[model samples]
Target chain A: MRLSIENLYHTYGKGLAFETAALKDVSFTIEEGEFVSFIGSTGCGKSTLAQHLNGLLKPDSGRVLVDGKDINEKTPEAMALRHRIGLVFQYPEYQLFEETVLKDVMFGPKNLGCSEEDALRRSRGALSLVSIDPDIFGQRSPFELSGGQKRRVAIAGVLAMEPELLILDEPTAGLDPQGHDEILDMVLALRKNPKLSIVMISHNMADVVELSDKILLLSHGELLKLGTPQEVFGDAELMARSGILPPPAASFVRRLAEKNSFFSSLSPALTTEAAAEEIAKALQGKFE
Target chain B: MENIIEVKNITFSYPESEEDAPAEPTLKDLSLDIRNGEFVAIVGPNGSGKSTLAKCLNALLLPEEGKVCVAGMDTSDEDLIWKIRSQVGMVFQNPDNQLVSSVVEDDVAFGPENLGVDPAEIRRRVDEALKAVNMYDNRRKGPHQLSGGQKQRVAIAGVLAMQSSCMIFDEPTAMLDPSGRAEIIDVICDLHRQGKTIVLITHFMEEAAKADRIVVLKDGQLAMEGTPLEVFAREDRLREMKLVLPFAIELADQLKARGIELPKDIVTEEDLMAALESLTAGRKTAGEAVPCA
Candidate 1:
């Protein structure tokens, strides 16, 4: 399904003594199967913009459209649109509550009113998708598992809903490097499904640059830049102004460009692999 | 030259819960000596006893098999536990959990007041600590109203008000963003420069690289311990322990594998940049190069 947000505006503590605008005139669109990333400094309205996608928070102005229909409409059909979009919050493992892992994973589908047999099937499928062996973990208590395992189980709970569009807010926060890679791998694997669209809010610039097809940069409740990873990371000054630097590879390339004029052609190397390749290429034809 | 904190063959295990399983030890035969005014970083994967070790340093968890001494005071001595704690103040992962008072200045003063310091002395310490963390301007603001970095600074101020000679940060930046992490790191480095010993436990390899020494743990045992240059050069051992190398080290290793002649000791970003600049200096173009789109 196509998800489009236009001219969105939101405020916190409206009419209060300490009123603050969290989002202002933010607009973006995510087509089916596209991977979009929202990045900025902390408290920069990235979460506020993501909340608008599934009607968790209604914008004070503008609209959120799912397949050209406003999701904010006060109708049963609009309310059901929430099931179409799944949001996995930061530290989602904290939301896990059940005696057994299988029971916890089944909660989403069961809450959606699916039959027991269907819920069981969906829960097993979701568990396996996240590489959790249902036979070994299904009977175990989620609280007994390791940090990474608990996180995968929590993500599986969300996946059981069969959300066509999955939104994860800092899914890998506080996880070790291995857990971080595992979560990213799960998201990438899920993107292989033709019906799935992924939107992630991330603070890790390297992960965002490596994974995102389109990146939306937000600053102080406003859209700063929305473009491909290359385009956004290429603008060093703008990213610096947002209190964030590009990934190490990109920053290295920019530094190299300043020192050696021959390196300016490859200004924004977004990944380590790309930086290595560019460095090799630049040195191969000369200086031998 | 003097050891501020010393752990001698400490072995620790958690008590069993309702879950049907054996209670395994979290720290096993771990021994470390942190020198006065030294900056040491403890790095390990999850469940490697990093946090357990931090608790042992300040007498929060006494070693079952061995002893921990802080500034010559034994932690296992019940009467000296408070003295050991005051000599080595700790800042934990969560800022919100540590901030006890609504106002920033009051929260900072709480530590000193609990220590039974004179009222005038408490005011002086609170002022100095807030200024040291660069949160003096926001001293009157409520703790919840500040940014994550600001709140963390206030938390550091609380610890600083105790007049501790050494600080132990237990993944203090784990819950913070990159900018927030930078702020905390900056504060820690400043404290280090001001002659306070620092023990930083972090999963971020880049942050660990700033330390004077690094101690790597695996399965509650000391897997590797050396300077950042020495420890990071053992890439195979670090990878086996499930710890990722810093970005510069990884990139340099990749480039080296692809026939680049970078030195083996390249761990920090500055080192990598310098190596690359020297390698590509001869190939500098004569005219201004075109900028990327």
Candidate 2:
């Protein structure tokens, strides 16, 4: 799906004494199959924007268009369109309330009017896509699984809906390094299907740099920048102003540049491998 | 320094729902000591008993087989449970769940109020705790008004108000943004500097690197324990246990593999940068002497 937000504005406790604009004049587009990321400091409206994308929150004065049709319109078609964009909230595992993992995953599809047979098929496919073996885990209670496994099952519930655009809000939060990588690998694997588009909200700059094709930077309810990872991270001043640090590799390279003129000419590498290669190349003569 | 908290031969297991089967032990025969004023980080992959161990420390979950003592009070003793809790405060992963009161100062005052401290003493402790976390200015604000980091700081202040000498944090920064994570870590470091014994359970290796010592857990067992430099040097073992090295250590490993000469003891970002700077200084002198074309 081609999802676009045009001049989105959202206010919390509107008209109350504590009224605050959560999102302000925000605009962006997620082309088909594009891996988009939203990043900012806490309370910067990243979550508010994600909720608007899936029609969970109506924009105060803007439009959320899925395939050029307003998702918020009060029509049967718009409601159906909203289902095509699935939002897996942060700590989604808490939403699991079924007797078994398989049933929990099938809940979404069943809610959308899928037949039992169809829902079962979709649920199994989703489970396997997340690398959870349905034959083994399908019979077990969702609560019995490990933390990472429970999170994957919760994501599988959204995937069972077969959303063309999947929105994950900090999917890897509270997970260990291995579990974090597992989720990222699952995202990469999902992108292999040309029809699936993914939007991830994350605090890990390294993961964002490695995974996102485009990044939307929000600060104090304003869309500060929308560009590719390189374009976004290359501007040190922009990053500093946003109160977000560059990826570790990029930050280390920038620090090196500040101390030595020779290193100043080198482009900041976003990944550790690239940064190590750059540093090694620079110090080649000394080692030899 | 005296050991503020001690875990001795502890093997803990949850009750099995099935009558015929027994639940697996979540923590197995683990023994550890936390010295007074020491900051220790515990890291492991998911389901490795990190949180289980944290719960054991403060008597949130008592060990089935062994004993836990906090400042000479046994956790198993019914009379000392409240005293032990007061001596070792715990901050959890979710900031929203830990908070009780609507206003920040009131929330911080909740712990001391529950202990039935004098009202004047409660007021003084609340003010001091809020100031320590740098949230004194937001004392009157509702808990909902604060950001995630601010909320976490409030949670920390709530613990601080209890006047706990040792703080056990279980993934406190997990739900925060990068800046929020930094803010919480800074508060934690500041608390540690003030001579509080700290037990930090985290998945973030970079945060763990700042601790005085590192404890690695795997399959409910202590896999490794040492200073950051000593523990991080065993890259293969850490990877085997499904833990990643801190960014600097990982980068240094990659650089060393590519024949870059860096000291093996490097763990933190500062150490790596210093080593690289000195190497660059060496290269500069060599460049002048050789006059490379």
For every model in order, the fraction of real contacts preserved is 0.46, 0.48
Model 2 has an lDDT value of 0.91
* Among all candidates shown, the one with the greatest TM-score: 1
Tens-place lDDT per residue, model 1, A29-139, is: 899999999999989998988888998998999999999888999998998876799998889999999999999999999999999999999999999999999999999
Residue-level lDDT tens digits of model 1 in B1-293: 99999999999999878767646799999999999999999999888999999999999999999889998999999999888888999999988789989999999999899999999999999999999999999999998799888988998999899999999999999889888999999999999999999999999999999999999988899999999999998988888888999999988988887887888878888988788778767655523333334
Model-by-model DockQ, in order: 0.46, 0.50
RMSD of each: 2.6, 2.1
Badly placed stretches (over 4 Å) of model 1 are: A259-266, B280-283, B286-293
What is the DockQ score, from 0 to 1, of model 2? 0.50
Among all candidates shown, the one with the greatest lDDT: 2
Clashing pairs in 1: none
Backbone clashes counted, model 1: 0
Residue A218 of model 2, lDDT score: 94
Error of 2 at B24 (Å): 2.6
